[model samples]
Target: MEKRRVVITGMGTVNPLGHNTADSWQAVREGVCGIAPITQYDSSAQKVHLAAEVKDWDPTVYIDKREVRHMARYTQFAMASAKEAMADSGLDLSAENLERCAVIVSSGIGGISTTESEQTRCLQRGFDKASPFYIPTSIANMAAGQIAIAFGFKGMCTCPVTACAGGSNAVGDAFRHIRDGYADMALCGGAEAAVTPLSIGGFTSMRALHVGDDPSRASIPFDGERDGFVMGEGAGILLLEEYEHAVARGAKIYAEVVGYGATCDAYHITAPAPGGEGGARAMAQAIQDAGITADQVDYVNAHGTSTPLNDSGETAAIKTVFGDHAYKMAVSSTKSMTGHMLGAAGAVEAIFTALALKDGYLPATINYKTPDPACDLDYVPNEGRSADIHYALSNSLGFGGHNACVLLKKWEG
Candidate 1:
């Protein structure tokens, strides 16, 4: 059987940079850094002092107060972004078959804040002091569940908890569902709100977080002085529909979901494989799946997490996959501004890639002063620029050796 074509109709995001897609994209294009001193909790006693937190968020804007009380921060972010995406798509759920719609939102660590708070309450008082909504709100799958419930989507509703790659994996899975004719349309993305003391302390113990207090230099990916990643929290969602189905409804298309590739290094649990061998394979597989040569790809939204291993390794992977063209293509890591959104990073970067294709612009890697010898790509340093990009790739590499890539093409029609 022939596979169906898939196209993205809408996108939404609530991240450290902004609360909506328009604001976030504009901040990205302008190279605004969102990292700053940790404001969610007092970090005076903590070794890691900075993070990229959603600024001045009010859940009541998207969800009712009573309902918001029962939801975790991650779920709230997911629902808020999903609401924007659904509205942007102009998808009349009442007119379509509910069973034909799907939701695949994911999170790496869901409700860690809730768990920490409830655990403290239990220990300080009693186990029975825990809220009845504890189990429902803290699970990683709740984001996908809540989105489906709110939108009345009675289709496949699931979440991918593949660490940092969870969001990209969710988008890829949803794309396959539509392309394989199992679903007609879907909402997919990832969310993460693990900025609690416990989450930050754990990552700090592993030496995975940047210890710098300077907001501008906290997430300087591919820069020589970079030491570690800055934890970020938020959600990003995209509305995808079959091409013919979307055209029939006169929906505005953002980009074509042309290819998806997923791979595992099977080499390590925390660190990436040597030379980013697994990431190279994932990119090669995505290019092959798209039926395009490596040279046709114009831009790459790299998974440059600012860690020594990841940046150098991902650079090697790009060179391996694209050879000399890797130097010519515009490559940048928006993480330089938004920090690392953990599982949500992939989905958010995917949305940025789609916007880049639609708008013919390439975001920059901000605060990049000294380039690493190993990572010598263009990086679109310091400032964004206009480009006639036809194809763009978004990459997400995660712990446990997982790597996922999604390819997007300009929507000419």
Candidate 2:
């Protein structure tokens, strides 16, 4: 049987850079850095002093005042983004088959704040005193579940907890569901709100977080002076529909999700494989799945996590997959500005990739001063530029050796 086509009709995001897609994209294009001194809690005692936090957040804007009490921060972010995406798609859910709609929102560490608070309460009082909503709110799958409930999407409601690759996996899974005829429309992405003291302290203990005080230099991916990743919090959602269904509804198409590739290194738990072998396989697989040659890919939203291992390893992976053509293509890490959104990174970067195709622009890796000898590529340093890219890839490499890549093409029609 022939596979169906899948197209992205809408996108939504609530990131440290902005509250919506327009604001976020604008900030990205302008090379704005969102990392700042830790404001979610007092970080004076911790070695890491900075993070990318969503500013002035108010859940009541998108959800009911009373209902907000039951939802975790991650769930709230997911719901807000989903609502924006659904509205942007203009798909009348009442007119469509509810059973054919899917939701696959994901999170790497869902509601760590909720877990911390509830655990504290349990310890201080008693285990029986824990809130009834505690279990429901703290689970990683609750983002997907809550989105499904709010939007009445009853089909294939699930979450991908693949560490940093969770968000990209969510988008890829939704694409498969539509392309394989299991669903006609889907809302998929990832959300994360783990900016609490416990989350920061844990990453700090593992030496996974940047210990810098300067926000601009904290998440400087591909740069020689980079220390580690800065924790970021947000959500990003995409509305995907079968090509025919989207065309029939006259929905505005952003781009075509042509290919998805996922792989595991089977090597290390926290560190990437030597030379990013797993990431190379995923990118090659995505290109092959798209039925395109290596040279056809014009831009890469790299998984440049600012760490020494990831930046150098991912650069090697690109060379492995694309050969000399890797130098010809524009590669950038928006993480330079957005920081690492953990599970939400892939989905948000996917959105940036789609917008790059749609708007003929390439985002930049800001704060890049000294280039690493190991990572020699055109990182679109410092400033964005116009580029009529036809095909783009978004990459996400996570802990536990997970790697995911999604190939997107410009919507010609």
Q: Encode model 1's per-residue lDDT on 319-393: one tens digit a residue.
A: 999999998999999999999999899999999999999999999999999978998989999999999999999
Which segments of model 1 are wrong by more than 4 Å? none
Clashing pairs in 1: none
lDDT of each: 0.95, 0.94
lDDT of 1 at 154: 88
User: Taking the tens digit of each residue's C-alpha lDDT, what string does model 2 give over 1-413?
Assistant: 68999999989999999999999999998889999888888889989889999999999999999989989999899889999999899988889999999999889999999999999899999999999999998899999998899989989999999999999999999999999999998999999998999999999999998997988789999999988999999999999999999999899999999999999999999999999999999999999989999999999999999999999999999999999999999999999999999999999999999999999999999999997899889999999999989999999999999999999999999
| Worst 10 contiguous positions by lDDT, candidate 2 | 34-43
* Candidate 1 local lDDT, residue 134: 99
Error of 1 at 122 (Å): 0.4
